[model samples]
Target chain A: MATYTRKNAWNQNGTFSNSDLLWYAKGVRAMQARALNDQASWWFFAAIHNEYLSGQTTFPGWAYISAPPAVPTSPLPSQSIRDKFWNQCQHQSWYFEPWHRGYLIAIEAQIRAIVIGLGGPNDWSLPYWNYFGPGNQYKIPPAFTQLTLPDGSPNPLFVKARYGPRNNGDIYIPLPPVSQDCQRNTIYTGSNAVTPNPGYGGPSTGFSNAGSVSGNLENNPHNMVHTYIGGSITSTDYGLMSDPGTAALDPIFYLHHCNIDRMWASWNAAGNANPTSTNWLKGPAATGGRKFVMPMPSSRAGWVYTPNDMKSLSQLNYVYDNLSTGITKQLVGSLAQRLTKLGVNLIQTQPQPDENMDMGGNSEMVGANEGALTLKNSGARTAVRFQKEAWAKVPKSLMNASVTKVPDHVYLQLENVKGKMDSNVLAVSVNHKLAGHVSLFGLRKASSNDGHHGGAGLTFILDITNLVDELHLNNALDADSLDVTISPDNDIPNDEEITVGRVSLHRQPQS
Target chain B: MTAAERSRRSVSLLIFVLSATCWGLLLVKPAAVKHCFVTGGELSRTSLEILLLTNPISPMLAGWGLMVLAMMLPKLIIPIQYTCERSFKNRRFRAASLFVLGYMGVWMVVGALMIGGILGLTLFMPGSYTPAIVVGIIAAIWQFSPVKQQCLNRGHNHKALAAFGRAADYDSVLFGFEHAVWCVGSNWVLMLFPVLLPGGNNFVMLAVTLLMLSEHMEAPRTPRWRINLSSKLIRILFAQTSIRLARS
Candidate 1:
């Protein structure tokens, strides 16, 4: 059978066409109508989430269920199914990408089977939101936002528990765009499970949970999207999407995860290699090594899977409709190689001279700002503004050279960060205008011995190359400075001090 | 060995020798104190007066200092090595010494305050277990408090050191003092547990030292209301043992 293709929700123009939307709504309604005990029912799909939240069980009966079993006497018992499922979901591990890939495939198969039974297209596949793609399509799809279908039946895709802005009739908040640069991280994994890597996946960790650190992609687009969609009104309560335990309950969860899985597939196609270590491919399940076991009620048995089994989308009978990950891979590879060489030379030959100025002189407490650069803080914003003079110390010639270089990425480095990880998503604005933001979801506090910790704190590097041009600061001849403002999406407690030891601007060389 | 490596070895040797001597003295000391006035212990007015009138560096104070050296100095290896690495080649020993001095200075002040507080308590009140029980409960409560976690987190913060001269000297000492204050804030209650325990058990002191060391080794955890004391401690112990075995 030909592999199914998962298309972007905004495959046509900038939004889901009326027909695609209709089919999706109908499929969801059909799945919801099935008996709660039915493996293909919406409730059955949701139970997988509940199992994960409850954590691993120790009961003998639950721990030893057979895999890919024959038809069950009753839809696998919701409460009684012994160790049948939810044993694996990779969080802060090298195998995060593959585990989630297998997970998405399992759900898609069940959903597709139901859709076909309801007379939908035989080759139907899950649709991705593609929130990082261009234009207003990043906003919640109209189909999901609508209270009822065109024929006036209640839309199953509409979830009431979503962020208020998303659920409230007309007023909608567009999903924030994640940096493409983060997706370009070349390393597959780091030295240890807890150390942060440039890879698309996180550091090594135990089953269904994150280690001390989170991967860049998982941290930003993956986590930030959840918080943004979940909303941030009450400081005490994280929105449904924000917390992993309840994230899947939201209808948008599957679609969002589908997009992440697609990105992983793209990352692989670009030229990076999945870990081939025995520990990664088939390590012991008890120690959170290799081998992911997920329960499949539709099949009436559990399935024990490995990264090797899920490495190829074709093996799972699926492909993305419009992915050009190869092109991105090549571009990023060349740029990264050039930067690595340049970095070595810079470190060896040139040490920055002391400017005799106190580095801490520029420190300021976060405050609300208005005017052309409107700093909105409705229980969801925390911002700090850096004056233009902060950049005066840098040589004008060097600054110009950094921007003119095509592939060279400029970054605002936040060093020695000390604050609660639960604070609002961090956004960077150039000269009062919004540039881009990074999600704090899954960020680990730097341990004392971590090389990156440097006794100060963890360092966060945000790419601001595109922001410079977008703000029309690219062509100024004289020493041009920017009022770079760093802000969070939610209010931090006044008593809690979130200090950035240093904020310096630097550029990475490109090929 | 390279000059840098040799310097590192010499510094480590010096630290190890000094620490071993203190620990040796501590291990050989009598388990029970006859004349010594234990902090928060049942006390008599005459014993309190004797403690107050004696020299600050009396045999009791010496024992306390030795205990601090043995239990706490092991935890300072990473920071000490870090300071040594950042100092000038000729002055590495000097920087390390100053850093140790600053760290010990903070602990000494804490020791003085503790002694003074005990003297005051003994002088004002009759011998009773009320203060000890209250302190024990407070220590248990603090184990699960957000303030304790914050102090522990702050203790892990490492700042960059200057490479040479007076600047390096000043920064090294300052960093040590800062780290010592946070460490004490994080672990003072645990340290006081044995002191307040009736008849001061040496095993409890040893257990508390192990706990302090293990907690410092792990990363900061999110503050939660639940305190699974035994399970967490067991996990840390197992992890430490496994690490040692792997290294061996």
Candidate 2:
């Protein structure tokens, strides 16, 4: 077997009309023509990730103006197939990285097989949309923007419903899709049962379709790209990528996930480690005695996978063309220089993957708002009053080196954030400075209340550790309350209100 | 210890003390608080009506309240811990106290109604093991019912409460009350079955409490009629034990 290399789509053949993209389009169209029940069909492959309401002409949270295509009907696939394979995307869990990696490989194999039968090259690999790369990469590739290909055939890559920032047919992400923000995280897993904010990869969960407390990587870039390309905050007609149920249907969804997969590889190359815990390594079975299985192209038995099986890219027989980008190299280089200055040899003092990576520790809730806040499209501010007793025990400076040997990390959480739309990117600021943006990706599924989170809705925890330290330096931390303003990135109508159940503050004093 | 950890320990301790006390009370006075509506404790319609009219409600309620505290409080540690941790440190005790009050208040009202219903059943229908058997069947049916699962799933939801002032107190009470309603919806039939039993009420209570705790530990799944033994915790323990044995 030949090792497949996934290259950046922007740099492929130095143009958009590369052989890889062309063959991918052809393969997708061919697959789309097959029956929905066929495992190798485009719809089946997408449904394996997630599926929309079976017979509903109108989807949830969608207005009458945006009627979805007729949902495919078929004689029921085997109960075993449905249970083992369909709708098994692992979101908001530690398995988010590994589950998707296996999923991509399975689908990639199917696509590659079809492409080969179509007389395409043998070495064809899935190209990723690295919007984080240099140049005008922020825009949708010109291939997806055009209504027709060079031969005047309808472009399978082009999706007309994509209502980007302008709410027009333009399907481009105005903001940077992903950031190095996720790379800073060291812990691979955290449990939502203990704390509101879990880990970098996600909280440990059992057979979660959409669990609570999404991992850091899954939250940003992954979600941000999905929501940004699918629709704007104000658009009523959201594209397929906007909703998780319909996200996998879009041709671009695979490319977006490919980039997310590449991010995991890059994070590893930077010396960050995955969890070695048996609970994580064993997949859902270790937690709930359930296995993570997907339908194989050739067999009815399907393929069973565990996080342990996915730890090695080389073992998987595929690798990204470039794992360590310039940005990653720069961050890793700076850290190396810092270690050298501290009289520690970088190579000799290399930390284990799990070392000092446990961010999901016991955090004390020091403050919270009195009630839920209805976020406005313009902006809304709320005050989180500090618990005077707990606040008294807090160090003068949050930065450990400045005040105490053990640094206390502070976090601001938006608990039970319920909204009907996925495009409501709330830019959260503390004391009039940008702290972080809360991406409403997968909001429709997550906020269903009937879903994994129950009626608690969605909770977002932002590590405002450095921001708090800056406040302390400016003597602003002495205040009885901290001002939190949540402003939407796009202008939304007054009717569509995003209700944040409560805005609370937590402090984790390192033990 | 952190306030949240302390609160959790405190709640666990409270459940322990309450359970011990209930068990002690049961051992000392097994016949002290018999539900006369039980299978063999039959009475005529006039006698039952007279007993209902003349009997002091306070003592009977006090007994039921004790039973509720012991059997139900174990399931509440998670909610109480969250309530305490979410509250301001100075107001933690007050918040948790109000939450208990709100929680117990709902159970007391529901318990009174249940007692009245059992008395009514004794008056109208001939009291036998049949009524107990029927209620048990209903409870079992409810255990697999979608509506009950929905209630159980909703029971896992913990609302974000206000940290200070009257609003905080109100929110704490509301949160507790909401949780108790769902708790009652899911398990009231099961609780009623033990009460209506001819005998072995204490033993049944213990069994039902354990069952409730096991189910509560499970993550919310799609509400359906399928069997949900909620052996997630048991699976975890089993996994841990096997791993340890292997390592050893």
Candidate 3:
């Protein structure tokens, strides 16, 4: 008996019908009615997000797993169990996709069981809110915004703490342009924790326990959505969705994550690879070899899963309604062209000798060693202008090639960053036009006491190829020298020292 | 052996000889000095006065220099090796020597300052354990500070050394100086503990050396409430042990 659950788009009118919404509301109501301490209760599910297990246990139904006697002396019997199982959300790592997939499955199973108990449909699957979907669908689903269901019962899905426009009125908050661009990232993974490869997933982080830098997908859209929803439009008060501890309490969080998970599926379908590293697949667990363990209802004996188990939806006995076929082909096809264009640009940029040059004549040799610049005490906006000689030395053939033919993907590489962790995002631009930005969300410098530099401060690579073309800098008529400006998204203190030991330009080869 | 291997062996040998010489001096030092260090015994007023009058610069510097060689040289092995690997094969010795000179120069200045401070304090404030005890407690507290961690982190930071010529020489010396500054910043308080103590006990010096090395070996600890608690507990335990020893 394959448990095939249909996950429809939240805002898809015909796909997620009125009856399905009613059943979901009823299931949520039933789950909420259960004692907070019960494993089946809504509170028990949310407690998993509140990492401080000992503190959360005060809200009934939250029980700790008893430690086996074989285990060494328990520090504080209760704390030991909480430490072992609680606080296990994998963020800022490659395992972000697979781990969350398993988590969603576990949560959905509990919801389905409740739905069935309430005399709802047997196949009551979770509805995904595809915020990145085609027009009008980006808005918050009406079912979630309504205070009451069709029967005049209080809607369990309604969360008052959400962003103003979505909660107060019908105005849907449009996704920021930064988030829209993240969807165009063709790469699935990066080499290290901070390689800024514009990958859908993050670099290889062992066990997904701790990471200094976040993957492009995790940093943008995923993180941005949380902050935007949680942050007030008028004031600085962060809503429940703002912090990871309280983010899950908002009903919309599940739907948002489901969409993200769907993106991963779509990314894979469009021809991208999940990390095959042993560290990622089994995870870097010392004792159990390599397995990701999640605490669930005792009867189910908790879900101990691996990345291998999450590769396909069939293994989990469920599939997204639009994951395989729909808009993915178009999205993937366009993305492939962009990636190919980048590859062509790399080839075009390579310095080649001119055929007109005399073979026997002494010609000035262009020095390969373009001098490196170190920027210290960089503020909110720091600009570096390339020396005229440096730009002049570039071979005429490399500069004369039509920018359209090349499919440009130029990158500004900021290497060996050392400083106190500043939360401000650095948005890179060429001349004055917008290029791309790197968020310093998780990559804060560890306080001196911890001695952890989070792998020696992250190396950010911001793609500025499009900016060059848009500014007409590739043309001979335009300025020969390039001006790269690093502008922080927020006002950063002028005194804060952010030492970029080396700054260089790189052309990423198309895979 | 290959030139590189031979150079590495020579560096190791130099460190070993210096350390052994320091240990030999400690073992064979005058009983008066030994008594002052081990038992926390104070010098008689007449002996102190005579010591202040006599030129003690040569002996004091030699002793301090040897102590630094024995205690700190082992810790420099990694940095020295890193420099050697980056340097041209033939110039490895020269690079290593210049690095050592730069590093030791910082310590020599610190050593001279300590001698001057100690001599002045002894001359003015005769027979006072108040300053020593206060300095010890402060040093202990400073161990867990963020500044200390920053210094340790800075000490761990190493840039790629240049392969040859003036660039190589400059990089080697600069790296040594940078490393020395951070190392001293991180460990100065701990180093000051034995110096400030009533007597220059070899045991106390060895204990401080071990503590410094242990902290260096451990991963940089972020300042967390739990870590602070544990550090406090360790301090309490150490105090308890000291009391027990005094009673015995």
Say which prediction, candidate 1 or candidate 3, comes out ahead on DockQ: 1
The best-first sequence of candidates by lDDT reads 2, 3, 1
Write the residue-wise lDDT of candidate 3 on A426-506 in tens digits. 666666776665544333333222334423454555655455434444453145345666654443344445555444543
Error of 3 at A26 (Å): 4.6
Interface RMSD of 3: 16.2
Cα lDDT tens digits, model 2, A212-266, are 5678888887777787787753445566787777778778889888988998988
For residue A342, what is the lDDT in candidate 2? 28
**Per-residue lDDT of B30 in model 2:** 53
lDDT of 3 by residue, B1-248 (tens): 11223445676677768777767776687432221221123433445556554526666676677777777886686568656644444566798888888888888788788777766656555556766787778876777677777676666555545443586688788888877888889777677667666655577778776666545544344332222212322343454465457659
How high is the DockQ of candidate 1? 0.08
Clashes of 3: 13
The TM-score values for the models, in the order shown, are: 0.55, 0.85, 0.57
Worst 10 residues of 1 chain B by lDDT: B32-41
lDDT of model 2 at residue A227?
Answer: 75
| Cα lDDT tens digits for candidate 1, A412-486 | 555445443333476766566666665554222242222123234445555554554343344441333446676
CA deviation > 4 Å runs, candidate 3: A11-78, A151-153, A164-186, A191-198, A206-211, A233-236, A286-291, A298-301, A324-381, A387-409, A413-429, A437-461, A469-473, A476-511, B1-248
